[model samples]
Target: MSSLFDPAQIGDIAVANRIVMAPLTRNRAIAGNVAGPLTVEYYRQRASAGLIIAEASQISPLAQGYLDTPGIHTPEQVAGWRQVTDAVHAEGGKIVLQLWHVGRISHSSLLPDGAAPVSSSSRRSEAKTFTRDGFLPVSAPRALRDDELPGLIDDYRRAARNAIAAGFDGVEVHAANTYLLEQFLRDSVNDRSGPYGGSIANRARLLLEVMQAIVAEIGGGRTGIRLSPLTTFGGTTPLDSDPQALYGYVVEQLAPLGLAFLHVIEGETGGTRNPPAAKPFDYEALHRSFPGAWMVNNGYSRALAMETVAEGKADLVAFGRPFISTPDLVYRLSHDAPLNELRADKLYGGGAEGYTDYPTLAA
Candidate 1:
């Protein structure tokens, strides 16, 4: 029987334990959207995690949606992340960057030359994004033409290469949470008609292409992808007309890629783990198709995580908020200790107060 605290192999990455730190957006990037010393210290503090999926970072300047979030497209940004990976490596921890593109979830103010955010459809999201002006409605996006898709694919490929350049062990493609890929994944949002839209395969085309490109650039053993089949991000986005068939096809398609792992959000992104009344998705079926490690996330308790691992239900368990408030979460869990309270107010864009100020058992 597998224990949650035992070491495991996640593809090319060897983890000390199955406790993972899910990618969290702190919006604390320095000038030019670069990870600074503070960002380095923040990740270094939580290096005890088996695998640290670093925060969602824009693959390009136009990929940004929130203020102060880091980017990986520029030389300065790459150098900035090198510091983070170095720190984690020194502490015997493994880290990977989450490559992101907000698509229609972004505001024009966050884009280059105020370009309208691009997406599978031009229809705008009712959701709001955190900008310098504060949370506001997302701007209408221009439908990405079929011709333009090659460039977008290249952007993902470049980001994967940049991750390697920055000394990361691997990269996790951010295709979840009603973001760019999810915008296309759901029939509720992508209303375009063309080779890039309409059918489920067409809808999943961009995401699959992005994954293939990244895998080719860095190999599948060094790549993972995150997916949220039923997450509406608190109804800011709607569910896919057929969440099961849609994600089912997605998981089946990704099986041959030999990915390192597939990180799944069980229910609502940060909301209920209990499947909603109307939305019914068989997550276990998806788990059965994948050959690599199966990492489960969203509101997991220590007992639940342990049982999930112990029962062979999930190979790894990812914790989001718990890791934020408890840097020594592994130790706390080992001893069944209490966790620190999260400073909700200072979650996004702040100094070390709520970001890295959380005390550990050693403190």
Candidate 2:
């Protein structure tokens, strides 16, 4: 019987186990959005994960949404990440970088020269974003002109190439949460009328185009994507009355690409997988829609992960907060050892206090 500890393969990457470290934004990058030595130590300590999807990294200067979040655009950032990948690979661990564009989810303070954030429409998210100064209200984003989308796609393409140059095993496109891609996918925010809006096909065009470009730059087997269908994080509510139809179509469209894997956050992003009070969407239906390797995230326990894999519900499971405090998460899960509680106070923007100082079983 297949177990979480059993070996699994996603595309060309071979993992020792099915415990994936979900892309978590630690907000610890140094000035210029560069991953420094501390970032290397943080990931290296957690290299026991079958696969580590590095935090949401901006694809361009305009993509940044938070202070100290890393970027893949500049040469310095690429070199900085090269150290991270090298450390992970040295420990026989696989790592992938997540390409991100915050869109309207960003504050003006985080934007280039205090420029307004950009999105599918001119909507200003009511959600607050973390800036160097502190948490601030998100600014209204300028509607991206139809002509400018190609430039945005190019940014993703360039970032994919940069990930390869940085020695990353692959790249996961961040389409989840309320980022640029989600802003375009949901009708609640997308109010444009053109090839990039209106119909479901139009709304999904940018994501597909970006994926196609990335696949063109790197092979499809080396690329992946993350999607959150029912998440309300960052104030992203479902605008479509039938989210099943919306995400079903999206997953169906993604199936043909033959990418590495599709990572889905089955519940509220960064929240419980099965919230008792909420009427959850039939995530199983969407999981069945994608023919590729499916990775389910959100509030997964060791027993639940093993059960999901054994029952053939998902091929892999991703853990987020647990990884923050347990660097050797796979070992702890495999041995049924107790886990260290994450310091909620130090979840973001800290040096070594709660970052790499989290003791493993060895300590």
Candidate 3:
């Protein structure tokens, strides 16, 4: 049986253990959407994880949605991340950046010149986003022209290259939640006609294109992607009508690319592992289709994580909220120690008080 604490090779990066720190967005970026010194310290403190998937960062300025979320598009942002990557590496940890684009889940105030957010279609989401004015309704988005897709694909390609330039071991494209790529994926949201939308093959085009572009830029070994087949954005969005068919095709297409891993959020994100209203979607089917590490997220307990790995259900288990409060989560899990409760407040746009001040076992 594989142990959760055992070393495993994920793509091109070799991790110390199978306990991964899933990406958690903390709106603490400084000016120019650059991760600051505190950001460096925050990651440095949690470097013991087998793998640290750094918080979601926008691929371009226009891709940004929430206030103060970091971006990997600019030179300054790359420099900012260099410090973070260097810090984690010094601790002998492997870290990867999660490339993001929020789509319609953004407000005008967060965009350039108060521009509308863009999406797979002109439909606006009922979702809200964190802005300078606080939580506000997302702005209506303009449908992206087919001609504009190449530039967007190039943006993702560039972001992957920039992540490599910034000293990251690899990059995880954030196609999960109700983000841009997922927006294009879920037929519930994507309402367009062209090469980018319509049938499952068309809907899967943009994500595949983005993946292929990134793989072409940095090679598939250094590439990973996150997917939330049933994450409903807190039930705000409808579940994809045919998740199994859609994601099955997605993984099947990704099989030949040699991706490092596939991070999947089981059930609703940050909620019940088995959502009552959700149709039964076969997660294992997707695993069999891909020839990469299978990283499962969403409500994973230490026991469950161990059992999954031991049974060969999953290769790596990711913990999100637990890692926020317990920087020494791997140690605690291996020792069966209790975890510190998360500070409900100060999750976003905060300083060290709730960000880096969480006490570890050593402290």
TM-score of 2: 0.97
Error of 2 at 182 (Å): 0.5
TM-score sort, best first: 3, 1, 2
lDDT by residue (32-109, candidate 1, tens digit) is 999999999999999999999999999988899999999999999999999999999999999999999988899999
Model 2 spans > 4 angstroms off: 234-239, 274-280
Ranking by lDDT: 3, 1, 2
Global lDDT of each candidate: 0.93, 0.90, 0.93
Q: Which candidate should be chosen as best, given lDDT against the real structure? A: 3
> TM-scores of all models?
0.99, 0.97, 0.99
Candidate 1 lowest-lDDT run of ten: 272-281
Say which prediction, candidate 2 or candidate 3, comes out ahead on lDDT: 3
Candidate 3 Cα misplacement greater than 4 A, ranges: none
RMSD of each: 0.8, 1.3, 0.7
